[model samples]
Target chain A: EADIYQTPRYLVIGTGKKITLECSQTMGHDKMYWYQQDPGMELHLIHYSYGVNSTEKGDLSSESTVSRIRTEHFPLTLESARPSHTSQYLCASSDLTLGAGYNEQFFGPGTRLTVL
Target chain B: AQSVSQHNHHVILSEAASLELGCNYSYGGTVNLFWYVQYPGQHLQLLLKYFSGDPLVKGIKGFEAEFIKSKFSFNLRKPSVQWSDTAEYFCAVAPSSGTYKYIFGTGTRLKVLA
Candidate 1:
């Protein structure tokens, strides 16, 4: 089983309320990613971190910001949440072992956010 | 821009029926293919992955996928599916070089009736 964890599996809040989704991994992975997925839709990468203090934006443009101060933790914060930001946020971590060009990612239970 | 495609959006089958889900990618270079399963209210887990050597790779729960380099396809199959196999299946492709990003399909929702 993967040690990746996401807090607030389900969240409901009003528009303009700032929220922070927590994601942590005990595996000490070097690569951590955050994706936004809608119901019955494909997951779109929003943010990713190669290692500590190395953060990059993914294919999808997201209004949220992320910080990777610690290797194990990658938290995403929305300054002013909107209804359009209400989607399932999934956290994933992967370790790039020697000779493995692309490693399989271990996903955490996604945080489903709803904005009213 | 590399992308993954899953033709089947939704599939329904009875117990003990054979299953096949199609997955095609746009990348022509060396790539790693993966199939992930997400059960109801559960996290996405790796069903199987194909790196090299074997064109056919078997995964847990009797799931198998064949990597066709010529066709740029990696399709998932199962001989007999059970009710517990009901879940959403996603196909992802990652190129060996250039970028570390993985492209994922829209996902196929499988429903098996017991």
Candidate 2:
């Protein structure tokens, strides 16, 4: 089973509230990613980390920020949530072992956020 | 810019019917193709992947995909689908070298009727 986990499977908050989504994996994967998916649409990459202390913005511009303080944990935070930010957030992690030949990402049960 | 395309937006099928979903990518270099499935109320999981070696790769739950480099296509197929197979399917591509970023298609939602 994929060990990745995301907290707060569903969240509903008023606009202008600050929130943080937590993601953790027991697989010890070095690469972690955050993706935002709207209903019936493709998932857009928002942020990714190659390893601890290394973070980069993905192709899609996102207002949320992420931190990778440890190999097993990566969390995303929104300074001020808006109705436009209502979407499902997915977290994934992949191993970077040499010659593993497996780039398959293990995903967490996404967090559905609603800003009212 | 590289991009992935899933021609079928939604598909409907009856139980025991054959299934095929089209996927194509626009990139000149070698790539790693993957098929992911998301059951209702579940997280996305890998169905199969083609990194190197054989063009035809089989995945769990009787799922398979063919990688055609000449056409830049990696299509998913199943001989007989079950109602439990109802879910959303996503196709993704990653370059063999450089960054590990993946380009994903819009996705195809399949509903199998019993």
Instruction: Give me the candidate number with maximum DockQ.
Output: 1
The CAPRI class of candidate 1 is high
The superposed Cα distance between candidate 2 and the true structure at residue B70, in angstroms, equals: 0.7
Residue-level lDDT tens digits of model 1 in B1-114:
789999999999999999999999998789989999999988999999988888999999999999998889999999999999999999999888875777899999999999
Error of 2 at B32 (Å): 0.9
Clash pairs, model 2 backbone:
none
lDDT of 1 by residue, A1-116 (tens): 54999999999999999999999999989999999999778899999999999999999999999999999999999999999998999999997777756779999999999998
In order, what fnat does every candidate score? 0.79, 0.67
> For model 1, how big is the CA root-mean-square deviation?
1.0
lDDT string, candidate 2, A16-108, tens digits: 999999999999899999999987788899999999999999999999999999999999999999999999999999975566455899999
In candidate 1, which residue ranges exceed 4 Å CA deviation? none
Clashing residue pairs in all predictions, respectively, total: 0, 0
Q: What digit string (tens of lDDT, one per residue) describes model 2 on residues B1-114?
A: 999999999999999999999999999988889999999989899999998898999999999999998999999999999999999999999887788888889999999999
Please report the TM-score between candidate 2 and the true structure: 0.97
Clashing pairs in 1: none
Score residue B42 of candidate 2 by CA lDDT.
90
- Tell me the TM-score of each prediction against the true structure: 0.98, 0.97
Determine which window of 10 residues in candidate 2 chain B has minimal summed lDDT: B94-103
